[model samples]
Target: MSEQITKVNSWVLGLTGGIGCGKTAVSNMFEELGITIVDADIIAREVVLPNSKGLKAITAHFGEDILLPDGALNRAELRAKIFTNNNDKEWLNALLHPLIRIKILNDLNNATSPYVVLVAPLLFENNLDKYCDHTLLIDVPTSVQIARTVKRDNTSSEQVKSIIASQMSRADKQQKADDILNNDRSLNLVHIELVDLHKKYLQYALHNKTNSH
Candidate 1:
């Protein structure tokens, strides 16, 4: 699976960050520069849309209680179910990860940008970064991550912290990243940095393309 994705005719830049580390903001900047973003989060939702094979499998295992009135998956109910049950979480992951990965690979293969940004919250955890030409991490302090998540999600601090705890540590992500963008400050500053990084990425993409020929 990983081999097929890595063999695609494009430079893949794997982008990842913690729960509330401004990944959307950064990805939007890349989009404005004409970069294609194959987001795993978006694909995750698409795979489980009403009438999808993923949803059918999930409904079979979890019952109709996991669906909304209109037949859409009740994401909150599924989240709660998996949160308390490790077996259920593993089962769901086993069922969905491959499906999501296949969709992601297809999207990446179809991308027409000079370099494609593959944004995934679980990039490293799922070993998706193995296909990337380079990995970029958006970093912020844990306190900042929790505070931003609480305000944005309207969830309790404890819930935000638990979500953080469930993800790879900031330090571990930092260690694995080929490039890191610290987004704890002003957007103006972040944009300025992103512009520079965009130029760098273009050069890297060009170099890779030339080497491949």
Candidate 2:
């Protein structure tokens, strides 16, 4: 097939959250409902993998220490350094954001589903809102965020707190969301919410299709 002739029918759904808000877990639930999920983190990592252009740009900016002995980007080191320095964060974003966006579009354009979920932690912060048809925000308390992230990431509370500080406030995220999921409940409850939302989203898509037709 020609590169431009791929048959992906994906409808991008932007997923966002504050740190440790279980956005990924929620997105996984959406995937269970048969939506194609195009994750930003995975695409970001893929673009920077060994011989990619993003990797070359990163190496040029941050030097060889950001690379493993085998030349892959040392994610931990780069993340720690970037978070502590605003300039580095901006520079890194400048170096990588465009490439990541292109890769995401390519994946979206190739997915074989009626819709795609774009899971991005800083979805609004990066102005990626333009790429999505609608946005979903996973809502949770700040304390829950700190606790969950510390346990899941095996990091200090302070570290998770710093990551949270780097993100937009939860209330702000909620305000911009087209869908709101409160994961402050049991897993079964969260799953129930996901199922309900999936039904609603399908109806929404059908509504648009019918109206357009």
Candidate 3:
């Protein structure tokens, strides 16, 4: 951890949480607090844009059916395919993860903030934790996750369960987090946690970016 803290510039923070875990809300609060954010979801999309290397690799593997009538990659189709076929998902991850990492590294290297926030759902899953000096997880109860996803997505209980099943367990996340912002109650409390975390992380100011294997 100390090694990681030494490698980072004063420009990157990794903020992560699973589905319906309020990571976006936390990141938005940080934005208001004047930190720039580099979102992995956005980077994911950028990597797959038409004719990019990622799209080319994807098309070569999955063929043109993965592309839309407008020529963009059919993300929904690919997502479903990957979810059902672990091999395909692994293959896809192999194709894109390195590219995304390179992009993120560049972005982090260039960020002009006291520190930037990286909101990634796969921060832990993809071994990107090494890129961050400190990792903050927005911890929410499984019950909260199920209730929130079902209500917000208008999905069934089983469907929400399946989504949660796809992510790393909450216990695993909590164990790995440097700071856990609890968000099982009021929105105001969640915001308060984010504010408190923002101050703490900013003051914590340990700029290490070691790429631990």
**Which 10-residue window of candidate 3 scores lowest in summed lDDT?**
1-10
TM-score-sorted candidate list, best first: 1, 2, 3
Tens digit of lDDT per residue, candidate 2, span 74-139? 999998999799999998877787788777778888777656788999899988888777788989
- Candidate 3's displacement at residue 101, Å, is 0.9
lDDT digits (tens) for residues 88-173 of candidate 1: 99999988988898888888889999999999999999999977889999999999999999999999999998888999999999
* lDDT per residue as tens, model 3, 64-89: 89999999999999999998999999
Best by TM-score: 1
How much is the lDDT of residue 127 in candidate 2?
83
Give model 1 RMSD, 1 decimal. 1.8
State candidate 1's TM-score.
0.94
Ranking by lDDT: 1, 2, 3
**How big is the positional error of residue 79 in model 2, measured in Å on the Cα after superposition?**
4.0
TM-scores, in order shown?
Answer: 0.94, 0.86, 0.86
Q: Which stretches of candidate 1 lie over 4 Å from their true place?
A: 1-6
